[model samples]
Target: MYTQCPDCRTVFSLDASVLAHARGAVICGNCETLFDALDTLAEQLPPEPFRLLPGHTRSEEAPKLEVAIYRPREDVPVAVAEAPAAPAFTPGFVQDRRAARKLPRRWPWVVTCLSLALLLAAQVAWAKRDVLISDPTIGAWLRQACISLGCRLPLVRDVHRLHLVARDVQAHPSVPGALMISATVRNDAPFTQPYPVVSLTLSDADGHRLAMRRLHPSEYLDDAAVLRAGLAPGASAALLIEVADPGNRAVAFEFGFE
Candidate 1:
């Protein structure tokens, strides 16, 4: 009983009635569209004259009509939106770190490694050259290490005996202290070489080793001709030797310049 509007696609109906005018316009209520009844009806009619009914009444039902449909060249769908399905696995099982605390912790060996490295470095430095012992007390102890090394100084004297000598020992800030003993190596060897070294040994009252030091007269001499100190072959150079521990000792003393 309703007629679909040609312009707005709304369903409307006009009762059977006399149409006096050839052209007229009507507004569609559903879509609020204005359309020409004259042109639209002309296409639907067979070019007939104005029709008048017994009374001026509009039909409750619209007469059967034919209309052509116009469609856009695009695609359209009726539903608004769709959702995707959920996955089987958990959301963050592969890359999450929150669960790491549940695992056991491991020991850190880095502290031990650093300590070992420092020890090794110290050993290397000490091993590079000879040692210097300068203390009179502990000098005896460290003298053992020196004697063990068997190092001797250039001889500037001989028969050249050593008297009361004090050995001093001091530790390097970065390294342990050493014993530095200063004793008298009396000049008794009449003949001398430019590279002369002193030789002697000392012990504690209990015959225990005390402190020892080396005295290289040539090495210590600013006089380049110390090697020429060679007593004209036989003439003796009465030399005076003093003893002092540069490192300072408390009790005993050891002597060995070699």
Candidate 2:
């Protein structure tokens, strides 16, 4: 029953059930200071310079019990050793500050699931951007990423890869009743496309239909720089058309593309 530590005077051999479960406060495993083990509550050991009993005071009341460090070992025979019961106040830096407050609550759900998986992969790459820009290696890497994102890219039309190749019609040696026609086309697509919509039709010599037209890359491209650079992969172009004579029973003609 001897207890001393009024600030490290270090004595400790406690056990009236460790001072009735420490209602007599304890701490000082060599200077960890805390006091009142019944204020130097002794049963012996009073012969040293230690002094504290004429009406012992120091208890201001706050440490309700937690035990473990009981020091008495002079060759070990002072036996009633029951102090080992401490762990309730959970101190290992308070469980490392509650594991650092559970890492900021899992970093806001790991930054909200990585910002919703990058906004669902940017809405599936903007909803398959025209089937991923018609894939010629993803349309040349999305036209080199839309030229630094200034953004334009749309041309690549396929029109069964456009073909025609050659054609002719006749009689317009200067437009009397007009009817020149002519053609060529080509672009068997490996990528660059665009100029198509030609169509014509005329028929009859029994083929029936008669007079139909469509034309348009500015009415058959009279070369304003090949109507702006389109149709390149395996290129070709020609075209000329004139029109007027859907009479003379149009002797059958046809062609189409768009």
Candidate 3:
């Protein structure tokens, strides 16, 4: 049976026979407050129905039942005299039961740590985005991820490894007042290099600059070339540029990578 303590409002379980033998009087185990269990005992009494009675008539009260209280004889033998009282029935006494608390599971923390590690790894991958995009094997995986994740690929733009191979400026035969320029640049580094920006300087016969033009990668590379594409070691590209004539005095030109 379940019992609730009135003093501390603590609920606990107890045996019915123990409660009956104790005569409905128990000390609260939680608050250490001695209280009459009979005052707050849980009992189910028979219900009485309401009925109309004549004003002059009187109702008889129900007879009460006599209960016998048992006590040991004072002239009992030595064995009976030495017997002890039941501890549960003693006043100011309570039963002590130590209950262990339950602990929460650890899988939640493990999952959180795993999630944080994945986030850190994703950040590192993004930081080295250019290198991954330039690698043929890794680039294929990255491109598939980009397609699935709805993301754009970043460009590779390292230009220090680019070197000018040959260049020349000549007058256009068909177009009046126009000059044609042709140049070849190579990737001289031991590793692959990114597309480069070319700076063209038109000069007079004495090497004094007449005009300058900056050519972006898009303006020079073919439509098949893309930002994620790279130049292999020792690979070269031929560039063709058209410009309005600088003048008859412009006799030479120079090309450089930025």
Candidate 4:
């Protein structure tokens, strides 16, 4: 027998045993529509281009039933009867209601894991700010980002990379009992660095330490702008220092950067 789904108008073929097992309720394989199999039931398909009627409606006139009568004739040869072909059954997929219900429950955990990952990255970045800022590539990227963020980075300081190229100490021509110290400091690092504190140590002919002095950037650099700009990479700065003469006892002097 054949039945058509009312919702999707899909035809399916099944036996009386299958229809009885489900009590005429069947699901459509194509549209997954649950409908009664008893409705629109047919023994054979209707003629071409003819619409199938609903279960409740019928033709105005009753369908005529034709009876077949069999008679044996000695002159006609007997033909063998062929068995009917089995009906084709299409299986329908059952929707997983539990899986659909579980889908929404997964989102909270997913969002939480993503937020934790971002938080951990932020913490690591904060803890290693100095190291990351010292890197050539990362520092350049950070500097460009800071421009748009209206933020400033502290100047890099590597005292070991600072060197005193030349230095001299002599009596001040204009000031009595005072000494004038001049030195050229260079930055050998690949990146810009802050001006270093210049330390001058004086010693006697016998190698006995006599006096010590420290000069800050503000004290040595006469230009305010240069003091704020810091020393550029591979650049040198000449600094002049005026101090009271430590006396003839101080014969030798050495400069160190800090």
Best by lDDT: 4
**What is the model-wide C-alpha lDDT for candidate 3?**
0.71
In model 4, which regions exceed 4 Å deviation? 1-102, 105-116, 136-152, 222-224
lDDT of 3 at 200: 85
lDDT of each: 0.43, 0.78, 0.71, 0.83
The full ranking of all candidates by TM-score, starting with the best, is 4, 3, 2, 1
Q: Considering TM-score, which of the candidate structures 1 and 2 is the better prediction for this target?
A: 2
Candidate 1 residue 29 Cα shift, in angstroms, is: 99
**Residue-wise C-alpha lDDT for candidate 3, range 1-258, written one tens digit per residue:** 545566676655566776787676777888987655544444432243422211222238765768958877768677667996555563332222212123456789999999999999999988987787667688778777888999756655566667778887788878999998988878765445667777888899898999999988788776655534667668887788888897888887888777
Candidate 3 versus the native: TM-score?
0.48
lDDT of 1 by residue, 23-96 (tens): 35666777777764433342132233524211224568988857858856765444433544465675585436
Query: What lDDT does model 2 reach?
Result: 0.78
The C-alpha TM-scores of every prediction are 0.22, 0.29, 0.48, 0.52
By TM-score, the best candidate is 4
Cα-based lDDT at residue 179, candidate 1: 35
Cα deviation of 186 in candidate 3 (Å)? 1.7
CA deviation > 4 Å runs, candidate 1: 1-195, 238-258
Worst 10 residues of 2 by lDDT: 76-85
Residue pairs clashing, model 4: none
